[model samples]
Target chain A: MVREIYQAVADGILVGGVYALMAVGLTLIFGVLDIINIAQGVLVVLGGYLSYSLSTRAHIDLFAGLLITIPAMFALGVVVHWAFIRRLRGAERTSMTLLVTYAVALIVEGVLYKIYGANNVQLSAPYTTASLHVAGFYLPWIYVYGFLLAVALVAAVYLLLYRSRFGRSVRATMANETAARLVGIDTGRVGALTFGIGVAVTAAGGMVFGATNAFNANSGYDLISRLLAIVILGGLGSIAGALAASVFMITLESVVTIWYPTWAIAVFYAALVGVLVIRPRGFFGRKEVRAQ
Target chain B: MIGERGAKAGGLVLLVAAAVAFPLAFPDPAVTNYGVFAMIFVTAASAWNVFSGYSGYISLGHAVFFGSGAYAMGIAARDWNITGAAVFELLPLCAAVGAAIAVPFGLIALRVRRHTFIVITIAIFFIFQLMAFNFSFTGGSAGLSSPFLTWQESVYDTRFYYIALACAAGAVALSWLVRRSSFGLRLRAIRDDEDRASGLGVRAMRVKLSAFAASAGLTATIGAVWFYYVNQVQPQTGFDPLFDLTVVLMTFLGGYGTIAGPVLGALLVEPGTLWLNTQPQLAGASEIVLGVVFLVVVLFVPRGIIPTGGEWIRRLR
Candidate 1:
């Protein structure tokens, strides 16, 4: 029984890493732009589609395809942020951007529907179905790879934020946009680029999502709901908080699913409400910096 | 220039008259079938306007209340043996159910940020839908049928049309009253700035919760009427996201913050949707159209169709 519980936790952590990767971009965009990109979920779909295209058409491996798709997605994100997000300003910016991103989401969903129809497509590879016997439990290779990728990318994001000049500028801007601008930082440029990078990470997350599950254009609807919940529970703008919250929530969900699958999904949502009720600031949320 | 109040009143009178006459004049049964859906949508959009347009808390999950109302009416008719023939019995039950469903859903996400509120709304909508789908008594995905209305009765469609029309008119009139009342003013203030409203001694949370409840009740009444008209209620059919988006679209398309907006939105968007749904090629394209309209409205005319219509009306005057 204890072993099974341990396995569930382990399995949950692995799945949660990939979720954290998907949610990190969502949180990052909110952190910088103060706009919840409703399209983030769709962008992840776009990433999966890109991988789908690459693996099926160009004969690239799913993981290797990220090498090309990440940059492609980043450029797409940059253009989107430049064209649409940069124009939004003022007090109503957050709500207004919801409409804007929703529009973007629709446009993407439409195009995907036009191409892919309503059918669910799953990514296939040798390792996709391959499971390794680890400590009396079967662990899927895709989950392990996906978790490693998430951890590595998260580390890279940390390095970029703490060690690089661009990261320094981003942190400065996040802390105080006007003050960052006063210090010779190009806040506009940082914001747009950061927004792009945030979206670009979804490429990795999306590949894993597509591999693990069959997805149609409508999949983003479910993905976004979960991502939004994770980010909000983690503290909207906090990366570390997103990681912790993602693991905690998903683990709870996965463990519960073993006992009662019906209540499993509801448990995560119930946890979000419970946490918020007790500590609205979330587990690692910074003091005095409300989600607003 | 036409004052906002005068324009709203004038538009309301004209709309009610037109709605009444159109159904009554529809000599063709097929044409009135179209009217029924349009009327129901107008009611839902008007109810959506209460919290989203006026209070500025855009709820993407309004389908929860709508679905609850649908299920309530469905269960009432199926289990209680309540006749859909009676309007008064069903309408109040629907309204009460809608309010009950929305109050807690509202409380769940009331204190959250704007986007988070949207997320919660969508989540609750799906939760309600899934719960309904899994429950056997509600007929799950197949949806429960309305208590058998007499098909042999010649006035079935005509009577259903009246119910839908009445529900739409009530939703519009109630929205107008709520918009003009002090409660509406307080909601508008919160919409503009919650912090400022709180600073000014307005109980922002309380005002929002009440608006949310009222909105839910209004929409749910229509759902009950809708169930009667359609004769069935499926979880997915009732709690569709596209319908929720359509309401948001119509509300914005007509004018978000105005009493005339939802009416204008329904008048404009519903017909186009019904017309488009007729085409097999454009079957799924309505969503695309709505998305495009959402973008255009936000970018070009953030105020909405009614406010813009008021502009044209003022010019003519």
Candidate 2:
């Protein structure tokens, strides 16, 4: 029984890494732009589809495909900002962005449905099915690699936000766009790039997510809710918090799955509500969020 | 542009007359079905707009209340052995259930600001959706079906149409009354600036919660009628995620916060969607079109039609 529990924790932690990858971009966008991108979930799924296309059609390795997909997603993110997000102004900026992003989600989803049809597709690499025996626990190679990548990306994002000059600018923009603009920072360019980078990371997440799960165009609906839950639980603007909350929540769900498999999903959301009620700013919310 | 109060009254009379005459004039099952659905959305959009639009808390999870109302109707019918038209009596029960869910849901979700409120609403929504699917009494995945209605087949759509129409009227009237009331002013104040509103002693949480409950109850009543009209209750249809999106789009299309905006949005968008859905070639393209339409409306007419048009009228005059 203890072994089984350990396996669930291992599984949860591994899967949590993929969730962090999906959620970090969402948090980053919120942190910098002060607008929630409803399209983040769909964008992650879009990332998966891109990777799938690359791996299947071009015979590219799954990890190697991210090189192409990330830049492509980044460009698309910039365009999304320019066309849809840029025009939102006035008192309803935050709320209007919600509508605009939802519209963007719909468009992307529609385009995806038009291209992919209704069938579910999964990414395949030899590593996807292989398991590594480590410390009496069998961890899938894909998940293990995914966990490593998640940590690396989270750390890289932290560095980019805190340890660099551009990071300083992004943080300044986040702190106060008007002040940042007064300081001669091209806040618009910063927003575009931040949004782009936020979306770009999802390429890696999507590749892993699509590899692990069967997904269709509509699969984004399911992912968005879970990603939103993770982002919220981690504190909206905190990437490290996202990573922490992801592992914690996923492990909790994984352990619960051991007994009441059917109830595991409900428990995931229930835990979020309970946590939020107790800590309205989430686990590591507000004070340590975003900037550092 | 409608400039005078008398002109507005005349327009309202003409519009209601047209709505009343719609199902009777058409009588086609499909056409009446469209009317029924349009009316359903009218009620739903109005219910949704009352809180989210007025209060500026954009919920992507209003479907929780919607689904709850649907399940309440279905469960109440089964547990009480009610059947036929008599099941209509469960409207209050469904409304109460919706309010019951909303209070706790509001208590938890509304504690946060607008953005977090949206996220938490979604979390609570997933909880309800999963419960409906997993719980044994909720009939699990197979879902519950309402008892068979004894109404004639030809008149079935018409009867549901009238029921939905009445509910839509009640909902719209409720919206009008609320907008004219101090509660609506307080909600708008909260929307405009929560800190200032609370500073002015509005009791922001209480006002928002009350509105949330009111909106949920209204939405639930409409959902119960819809469940009865459809004769079945599946998790997907009852707790539909898209339902929230569709209503939000409608409100945005017509104009958010304006009383007539959601109604106009529902009357237009619902029928258009139904027509698009019925199209053979465009069958898979409905969502795409809806998406495009949502983008167009938000980008070009973000303030929505009623407010924008009202501004246009003022400018021209």
Candidate 3:
């Protein structure tokens, strides 16, 4: 029983890493832009489809496909920002963005449905089925790889935010957009670039996710609900908070599933409410910084 | 001014009379079925508008209340052996169940900011959906059927149509009343600026909770009626988050926070979607069109039709 519990926890941590990777993009966009990307889930699914097509048609490795999908997704993000998101202004921008992004989600979902015909598909590779034996426990290779990739990407994001010049501008914008603009940060450029970078990370997350779980276009709805819960629990715009919350939630869900499979999903959300009641701003959220 | 007021009152009376007589005028089963769905959506949208439209706390989880009401009716009919007249008797119980769920849901969810609140609602909604899928009493994913209403096929659609119309009218009237009350002012103040409202001695939490509860109850009542109308309840059909989104979109498309907005939105969107559904070539076209319309409306007419039209009229005058 103890061994099975340990396995569940181990499996959860690996899956949680991928969740963190997906959530980081959402938090990054919220931190800098003050807009919740309701379309983030669909974007992740789009990344998965991109990877799926490349792996199947071009015979590219799942990890190697990111090289192409990342840039493509980034460009898509930039176009979306430039076309629809750029025009939003004034006090109602936050709520308006929610509706606009939802519209974006619908359009993308419609396109995916039109092409894919509502069938569940997954990215397949030898690694997807292989497991590593470590200390009398079997660890899936895709999960291990996914966790490592998530860690590397998260570290890369941290370095980009804290160690690079562009990172400095992003932080400045996140801190105070008006001040960033006054300092000649070209806040609009920063917003667009940050949104692009945020979306780009979904390629890695999506590849890992699709490899593990079968997904259709409609899967984005469930994915968005889960991702939103993770980010909210992590403190909407806090990167580290997203990371911590992801692992915590996934672990809790796995643990609950071991004992009470029926209530596992409910427990995940129940924990969110329980945590928020004690700390409404979330784990790493600043109290005064209301989502405007 | 008096003439304008009289004209407005006359228009309202005429509108009500028209609405009450609609099913009679068009007794075709197809038309009545469409009317039933339209009225149900309008009621749900109005219920959504009462809380989200006024308080700026957009709930993506209203399907929870809606599904709860539906499940309540389903369980009562199936488990408790309630049938025929007893099925109608379960309406209040279903509504109370909705309000009951809303109390705890609102307590937990209302503590967060609007953005976070939206996330919480989504989370809770998924939780309910998952529960519905897992719990055998609710019949799991296979779902439960209401006690088959023995109404004749000829009058069945008409009967449900009137019930739906009544529900919609009650919901709209409730929304209209709320909008004109001090509670409505408090909700609007919270939407404008929560900190400022609270600073001015408004009990933001209580006001929001009451509105949320009221909205849930009304929505659940409609959901119960819908369950009976459809005679079946599935997790996918009952707690579909997309249903919540559609209602929200309808409210927004018509004009969030206005009395006529949700009604107008339902009028436009419901039939439009039904028409799209009927077109054999356009299987998924409605969502795409709705998406484009949503983007355009948010970008160009964020204040919605009524307010924007009112502005246009003022400009012309």
Candidate 3 per-residue C-alpha lDDT over B61-128 given as tens digits, one digit per residue, 9 for 90 to 100:
89999999999989878887877856888888988999999999999999988888888998889889
- Candidates sorted by lDDT, descending order? 3, 2, 1
TM-score of 2: 0.97
Sort by DockQ, top down from the best: 3, 2, 1
Candidate 1, pairs of clashing residues: B254-B305, B254-B306, B255-B305
> What is candidate 2's CAPRI-style docking category based on DockQ?
medium
TM-score of each model, paired residue for residue: 0.94, 0.97, 0.98
Q: Write the per-residue lDDT of candidate 1 for residues A215-239, one digit (tens) a residue.
A: 9999988788788889888988899
Q: Model 3 chain B, poorest ten-residue lDDT window? A: B77-86
Between candidates 1 and 2, the lDDT winner: 2
Please identify model 2 stretches exceeding 4 Å from their true place. Answer: A287-292, B1-3
RMSD (CA, Å), candidate 3 to true, equals 1.4
Candidate 2, residues A100-193, lDDT tens digits: the string is 8888888889889989999999999999999999887888899999889877887888899999999999999988889999999999999999
Give the DockQ (C-alpha) for candidate 1: 0.49
lDDT of 1 by residue, B46-106 (tens): 8999788888888898888888888898887777677635634877988999998877777
Prediction 1 TM-score vs. true: 0.94
Q: After superposition, how far is residue A229 of candidate 2 from its true place, in Å?
A: 1.1
lDDT of 1 at B217: 92
